[model samples]
Target: MAKYLILIYGDERRWDAETEPERAAKGAAHEAFRRAAGEGLLGGHELEPASTATTLRSATGTAPTPTDGPFLETKEALGGYYVVEAPDLDAVLALAARLPELASGHGGVEVRPIVEHG
Candidate 1:
């Protein structure tokens, strides 16, 4: 099986404003996804808000400079991710399409193959 990384992007502002019940609903959805994925689910995590993020950048010959926030300014910020092992891209895509973020209509998923180094 091949491995894929599923990146979940969403509106941080909206997510922050969600009520406790709303958050619980979304969490339950994620649990359902985990159950569906079963053996195919490798690993996953939900991140803290982008405000807590630190970005580090370095030039070819300079020391790395740390910034206070995300690497880019955008309406959507990465909220979570899942790494899964699947038979192929199609199989992974099918799994990704079931993500709660997509159903919420405030987010989207990106799937990328993990490069294997020998």
Candidate 2:
């Protein structure tokens, strides 16, 4: 089995714009995923904070620095992610499609494989 990271990207700002019902729905979605994930339906996962993140880089500009917020300028950022062990990317994509948080609305989900380091 291959380990993949299901990155959930979206407009964090829009979360504030969502109505009460919308927020509730999102919460419910999260709960559902948690339950499923615990049951081996989902391998392992985590939900990160909003797009406003800290990015640091070297002072000499050797590497991009992280400060109070994200390095990239975009409406949708890497808000959260899920780590799952699946057969392949397609299997992960199928899981991605089922995520309401990444469903049609704010942004899209990105499927990527993880590299192990000794």
Candidate 3:
């Protein structure tokens, strides 16, 4: 089985401004997605803190420089991810397409293969 990392993105501003019920509904949708995708899931995912982001850059012979925010300052940032196994890209897409509508337009989800570590 091939493993894929599904990264979920969205508008932080919009998410921050959502009502309690709307937030809860989106949470429920994510849970449902996890349950449905669990049949082929290799691992679970997480939701990152908005203010916890730190950026880094290459420093000249010293160390990687650290910055304050996400690598990109776009309204959309990586909100969460899922790791799942499938036979092929088509199977992966089928799962990726199942993401919630609220998660759409805000940003989007990205699917990529996982590199096996020794």
Segments in model 3 whose C-alpha atoms lie over 4 Å from true places: 101-104
TM-score of each: 0.94, 0.75, 0.84
Score candidate 1 by TM-score against the native: 0.94
- Candidate 3 per-residue lDDT, tens place, 24-82, comes to 88778878877877778877666765568887898588889898777766767788888
Q: Per-residue alpha-carbon lDDT of model 2 for 1-118, expressed as tens digits?
A: 7877878777767765789998788778867766655533444454455444677778674876568866768787776677777777776687677777666488788888889787
- All predictions: root-mean-square deviation over Cα? 1.0, 3.2, 2.1
Cα lDDT for residue 39, candidate 1:
95
Enumerate residue pairs that collide in model 2: 55-65, 55-66, 55-67, 56-65, 56-66, 57-64, 57-65, 57-66
Candidate rank order under TM-score: 1, 3, 2
All candidates' lDDT scores? 0.92, 0.71, 0.80
Evaluate model 3: give its TM-score. Answer: 0.84
Compared to the true structure, candidate 2 yields what TM-score? 0.75
